[model samples]
Structures are given as C-alpha cells and as structure tokens.
Target: MTDYAIGDLQGCHAEFVELLERIDFAPARDRLWLAGDLVNRGPDSLACLREVRALGNAAFTILGNHDLHLLAVARGGARLNRKDTLDDILAAPDREALLDWLQSRPLLVRQAFDAGGDTVMVHAGLLPQWSADEAAGLAGEVEARLGSERSGAFLEQMYGNEPACWQASLDGIDRLRVIVNVLTRMRFIDADGCLDFSAKEGLDSAPAGFAPWFRYPRRDDLRLVFGHWAALQGRAEGARVRAEATDTGCVWGGNLTALNLDTGERIGVSSHLRR
Candidate 1:
C-alpha cells in the first residue's frame, strides 16, 4: 500500500484527478494525504471536494485558511473575495454535504509509523513551543469547536490575527483563532514565537530576529508536513527539523505534485486546466 502526500488542491480538480491517474492511484490499495485549501481561486472546487470526500478512509486531510474561509462565507460570517471561485461550491446541490465534509476535516493529522517515525500534517506550521502531541491536542481544541453544533458561530470569530502569539491563558475566540492561524496561516515567527504575518517570502527574507517556524530549535520534535506556503514549492526544508512543503502552486499554472511519505519519492503532473 503506497502512501502519497499531495499538495494543495486549491480547486484544480482536473489536475488532481490527472495526478491521481498519472500515479495510477488505486484508492482500494493506496492512501492519500491532502494538505488542504481544497477549494477556491481555481476552476473546480466542488469536484475536488467531492472526489476527495468520495475516497473515504483512503484519504486523510487537514483544513487550510481558504477552506476555513469557505465555511465562514457559507455561514454568512465572511464575504467572498472577487477572486474567489467558490460560487459553484456554494451553489451545488450537495453544498450542504460538501461543507459538512470540509468542516469535519481536522486542522492537523498525525500519521504514525510502527518504525518509530511519525509525521504531523497541518495546513501550515506549528508553533515552536509545542511537541507533536501537544500540537495535536491544540488542534483538537479547534476541531472540536469547528465540528460542534455552533460551528457557524465559531467561523464568525475565526478571522483576525490578534494575540499574535501563544499563551495558555488565552480563552474563547482568541485562543481558537491563534491555533487556527498557526496551523493554517503562519509562515515566519519571531524568537519569542510571535507570528509575523507580513513576511511571506523565502528564508532570506525573514524579518530581523525572526525566522521560519521550522527553524525554531524546539521544532525538531515532529517531522512536519505542511503545504500553505507555496513559495517553497514541494521541497521546503529546515536546517534540522523535518518541515516538508507540498504546495507547489498548481493553481498558479504550476504542476501538481505528490510526495511519497515512506519512500521519499515525488511525482508531478503538469496543470492542463487554467488557473
């Protein structure tokens, strides 16, 4: 059984399907790990979500910023950007079911191997202070709220970047928002673990006294597999920590990519659909 970690779908369903076919993926045998942003800004988000959901246990996923935005928008808590192509998804007959499936996806996924190896897959980065286990627990805090009966209320408060850092003392929306940001929107962070939202450039562009989250000393705990930062493509790595980027910007006219978790092998399929 092969295990493939795919880059963000970002609504490029055709490319996703093409990549699957190129790999000759058999859902009955092979497993798939999706890094999220499964919709928006591309051609066919509905199809992407439907196809991935159809895979059932053969597929594992995490939530991305855009994916969360979709939930917010669907619940009337957020407005759609001009570039957003989610109209089709929100208008689909199965829109309720699709959004339900999406909101049900966890913010972080921990894939354990009996070989004493484990990898944490999140939409973005994890705070340096938390170990993989702590991170998963942190994620659960958000997942539980997102899947609750009042999830729409949670989405209404999902936006904002305040509290810019982690503090166990935080409660309510602030706590959940920070957790969501770190696991979905974070790219660079200061030495004190305060997230820098403005700097989205490569490593050399890190603000003074701030560095990529994966470079933090304490991050070596879990082998992290994340995808939100497309600038690094599929090879974003750190000095010692295992932070692998799978978002190759397929929606930007780039090729879709997949990385094999166990074998460290990667495969690509050129995007034939318009971004």
Candidate 2:
C-alpha cells in the first residue's frame, strides 16, 4: 500500500492515465496524494476532474490556485483569462458537483510516518512562519468558509496580493487571503519573509531580495511535497527542509511527475503536448 504524490494535472488526462499505468496504481491498495490544479490549461479539464473525483477515498487533493480560480469563476468571483482552458469543465453537466468537491479541499495535508517525522503536502509552498501543524489549522479556517453558504462571497473577495505576510492578529478576508496565497500562489519570499507574487519563471527569475520559499529555515523534521512552479522542472535543492517539487510542467509540454513518499522514488511520464 504505497502512497504516491502527483504533481499538478492541469487537465492532461492522457498523461495522467499513462503515469498511473506506468506506476501500476490500484485504488484498492494504493493511495494518491495529488498536488492540485486538477483542471485547467491543458486539453481535457472535464475529463481530468472526473477521473480524480471518481478516485474517491483513494485520493487526497489540496486546492491549487487554478482550482480556486475555477471555483471563483463559476461563482461569478472572477473571469477567465485568455490562456485558461477551463471552459470544458465550466460547461460540463457535473460542474456543480465538481466545483463543490474542489471547494471542499484543504490547502494543506499532513500524514505522519511510523518511522517518525511527517510528509506535508500543499499545492504551492508554506509561509516561513508556519509549522506543519499550524499551517494545517489555518487551512481548516479557509476550508470551513469555502464549504459554507457564504463561500460565494468569500470567493468573490479571494483575489488580491495585499497583507503579503502572515500575522496572528489578521482577521476576516485579509487573513484568509494571506493563508490562501502562502499555500497556493506562493513561489518566492522576500528577505522580509513576505510573499513575492511577481516572479514565476524559475529560481533565477526571483525578484531582488527574494528566494524560493523552501530556502528559508524550517524548524521541523517533516518532508514537504508541492507543485505549482513548473519552471523548477521537479527539482529544488539546498532547502532547510526536505522539499520535493512535483510539478514537471506537463501542461507546458514537459513531463507529468509523481513522487513515492515511502520509497523516495520519482516516476515521470512525458507530456503529449508539443512544446
């Protein structure tokens, strides 16, 4: 019963299936931890969502920025961008079910290892100030709001880059926004420990005084698994914590990647999309 953590699907259904086949995944025996972005950007958003949702209890998924964007757009909180490929999902017959399932996902997931330590999964990265347990607790706050009747209103105010840093005193929408950004949209952090949303290219494209979030020292023994920065191409080393990057940019004509949490093995399937 191995647990595999997969990178962002981004609607690449064929590659996703191929990767599962390559790994010989059996839902009855093995469990999957998905790093989110289950839909959008690639050719088959609808199919991807269906496939994951059908996995049921065998799969655990955290909410990515793209996933949240889909929910927001569906609820009239945001508009689709030119590059988005989420129309199929929006127009699907089970759109409501899919969106509800997605909205209920948490921003952080943690699993403890029998050998000690833990594996923490998030769509992007965690704020330097947050420990694994603290992040999970904060994520629950957003999950509650998203799963409630006022979710549409929360989604409407979910966008933005303000309150760029974490503060215990933060409340209301501002606090929720910070938690969401750190767990979903985060890539780099400035010297002051604030999130830098401007850079998305790669490590070298980090804004002045900013570096990848994992570079900061974390006083925990947990391993971190995350997707979202495809530019890393599934590698980010020299971090204080044991961080595994899983997004191999399958939507950008790269490979779909999965990491075996128990064995420290990585398997990848090349994307069919032309570069």
Candidate 3:
C-alpha cells in the first residue's frame, strides 16, 4: 500500500482533484494524509470539504490554522476576515456533517510504519522540548473538548498569545490555548522555543532571537511532517527530522505537492486543473 501526504488544500478543489487523478489514488489501498488547511482562501471550499469527507477511511488528516478558523467561526468564537473563503462552506447543505468531521480530526498524528520508524504529523512544527507522545497527550485535551458541545468555549479561548512559554504545570483553557497555537499557528520561534508570532516574511534571516522551529536541535527523535509555512517553499530535510510543506500555494498560483513516505519521492500536480 502506498502512503502519500499532501500540503494545504486551502479549498483549492480543482487542484486537489487533479492531484488525486495524477496519482491514480486508490482509496481502498492507498492512504492519504492531508497537512490540513482543508478549506478557505480558494474558490471552492464547500466542494473540497465534501470530497475529502467522502474519502472516508482512505484519508487521514490533522487540523491546520484554517480548519481551526472555520471551527472558531462556527462557534461564533471569531469573526470572518475578508480573505476567508469559509462562507461557502458554512452555507452548504452538508455543513453540519462536514464541520463535524473536520472538528473530529486530531491536532497531531503519530503513526508507526515499517520503513519510516515513528512518524509524527502536525500542521506546524514542534518545540524542541516536546516528543511525539508528549505532544499527543497535550493535543488530546483540546481534542476531547472539541468532540463535545462545549467546544465553543474552548475555541473562544483558543485565540491568543499569552503565557507564551511552555510549562507542564499549565492547565485549563489558557494552557490548552497555548498548546493549540504551537501545534497549529506556530512558524518561527526563539532559541528558548517560545513562539515568534509576528514574522510572516520568507527570509533566511530571522528577526533577532527567533529561528524556524525545525532548526532547533531538540527534534532528534521522530520524523516530523508539517506544512503551513509556504515561505519555506518545500521540503526541509534533516537527518531524522523534516518539514514537508505540501501547500505549495496552489491557491496562490503554485502547485500542490505530495511526498511518498517510503521512498522520499515527491509528486506535484499543477494548479492549472487541465493536466
């Protein structure tokens, strides 16, 4: 069975479909891992959500910033920004089922296969201090609440940048909020692993004390699979650690990317729709 992971869909349904056809993706045997951001900013959020949800057991996805944004908006936790393409998804007939399925996806995923050893996937990179199991445990807290009706309360508390450092002693919504942001919204961080939320520019030079989260030496254990920083362009491979940026900005006039985990082979499907 082949295992493939793709970058942010950003609601680019046309490109997503084309990528599947290019690979001749067989849902019965091949496994697909989506790096999240399944909706928003592209032309067809509703269609993208429905198609992926229809994939059922063939798909394995984790939460991304856009996915959380949709959840937060649905909970009335946040207001929709002008660039957001979520309105179409929110107004769809399958809105409830789609959102329900989306919300149920994990903040992090850890899978052990014969060739890749232990693999951990999250939307953004991880702090050096966290192992996969440790991250998974923290993610479980938010996942449990999200699986319940009380999720709105959690999503409302989810948006912020306080208590800015990781502490095992942190509890309640404040603690969980920090965890979710690190796992989803994080990109650059300081030597201390504290997040630098202000930088969006794609440059080799970081602002003062900050560095890309993956550059830190602490991630020496499992192989990390992540997207979200389109600025990185594509894959940043390290000895045992890596960042796979599948969201090559298909919605932003770039191609969609997929990586074959077993061979480290990459496949791209252009956004032009007609391949």
Candidate 4:
C-alpha cells in the first residue's frame, strides 16, 4: 500500500480533495498520514473533518494546536480567535463524534519500516532532549489524560506557556502542558532548550538565542515529518536529524502539499482562496 503524508488541512477541503485525486488515492489500497490541523481558518472545516473521519483506518491523524483549540473551546476551556473558521465544525450534527475522534488521537505516531528506519510524525517539532521512543511515552501521558474522565479539566489547564523548559521531575498539569506544547505548539527553542512562542514566521524571524527545534542535535534513526510552520513552505532540514515539512499554507493562499513517504515525491494543489 502507498503511504502519503499530507500537511495541515486547515479546512481547505476542496484543495484536499483535489490533491487526493492528483495522487490517485484509493481508500482500500492507499493509507494517509494526516499531519493535523484538519479543521480551521479556511472555508470548509466541517467537510474536511467528515471526509477524514470517513476514511477510517485508511487515515491516521495526530492532533495539531488548532485541533486541540477546537476541543478546548467546545469544552469551554478556551475562547475562539477572531480569525477562527471552526464554527461550521462546532455546529455540525456530528460535532461530538468529530471532537471525540480528534481528542482520542495521539500526539505522536511512529511507523516502523523493514528497511531499518522509522518515520515519526508530529504536528510541530520534538524537543532536543527526547528520543523518538521517549517522546512517544510522554505523548502517552497526555493521551491518557485526554482519553480519561478528567479530559475536560485537562483541556481547561492546557492553555499556557509557563514552565517553558522540560524537567524530568515535572508532574500534573505542568508536565502535560509541556508535552502538549512541544508536540503541537513548538517552533523555535531557546539556547537552554526552552520553548519560545514568539515567532511564527520563517527561519529569518527566529528570535535571538533561539533556533528551530529541528536544528538541534537528536537521534538519527528516524525521519521526522511535521506541519504547523506554514511559512517554511515545506522546506526544513537539520544537521543531526532528518526533518520534512509538509505545510504549504493552503489556508493562506498557498498550495496544499503531500509527500509520498516511500518514493519521496511531492504533489501539490493550488489554493482557491483569494490572497
């Protein structure tokens, strides 16, 4: 089966459908690794969520910041931003099912290959201190909370930037928040390995003493695929680790991109949104 990893959908359903057609995707024969942010900021949030959900086992998704924000808002844990286009999803008849499915998704997914390397997928980037397996374990900590009875309470506490640095002794909400941030909201990290939420632009916009997380030294046995940094336009690499970016900013008038994991080929479809 062909495995294709696509960037953040961000509610651009038409472009998503077109890209699928371009790749000649067959649900029975091909698998999809969606890099998250499946809904928000574009015109068709509900449709996008529905289409992906219908794909069932054919599609595997991780939660992005926007996806989590949607859950938080629905649970009264966060407020809607002025630019958010998530109303359609929140108001849909299948909203509960969608949100439940989203919350049930893991923060990290790893696919092992017989060829001696694995592909690790996250919505954003990994911390310098985490090996892929360690990250997966930490991700499970948050996933357990999200899938438990206290999930609503956890969502309420999931919205902060405090405790920016990681520590082995961290526990409770602080620990969960750090895991969430590193997996979903991280971009650049300070010299001390603390997350810097200041910049969302390209590499040139990195704050002083901070650099893209992928640039730091890490394990080399896995390929890290991520979305969320739209300004990168599907281009990012690291000296010590292999990283691939797939977010091409479809919601911001750029093209939607998908990377073929096995063949390393990229296919894209232009956004219809006016710039």
Q: After superposition on all CA atoms, what RMSD does each candidate show versus the true structure?
A: 1.6, 1.2, 2.2, 1.3
Model 3: lDDT equals 0.82
* Model 2 C-alpha lDDT per residue in residues 1-275, reported as the tens digit of each score: 88999999999999999999999999999999999899888999899989999999999998999999998899946899999999998888888898888878878888886643588899998877788778989999999888784547888788799989878989999999999998899999976669888899988898888889989888877788999999999998668778889999999999998888888799999999996
TM-score of 2: 0.97
Candidate order, lDDT descending = 4, 2, 1, 3
Stretches of candidate 4 off by over 4 Å are: 114-116, 237-239
Provide the global lDDT of candidate 1 against the true structure: 0.86
| lDDT of model 2 at position 57 | 92
**Candidate 4 lDDT, 1-275, residue by residue in tens:** 88999999999999999999999999999999999899899999899989999999999899999999999999746889999998988788888898888888888889985542699999998887888889999999999888983447888889799989989799999999999999999999975779989899999899889999888877466888899999999999443578889999999999999899888899999999977
Worst 10 residues of 4 by lDDT: 108-117
Ranking according to TM-score, highest score first: 2, 4, 1, 3
Candidate 3: tens digits of C-alpha lDDT, residues 192-252: 7788778875746467988778777754567788888777667563322455566577777
Report the alpha-carbon TM-score of model 4 versus the true structure.
0.97
**Candidate 2 accuracy as lDDT:** 0.89
Q: Residue 50: error of model 2 in Å?
A: 0.4
The lDDT values for all models are 0.86, 0.89, 0.82, 0.89
Choose 1 or 3, whichever is better by TM-score.
Answer: 1
Off by over 4 Å in 3: 237-240, 273-275
Q: How much is 106 displaced in model 2, in angstroms?
A: 1.3
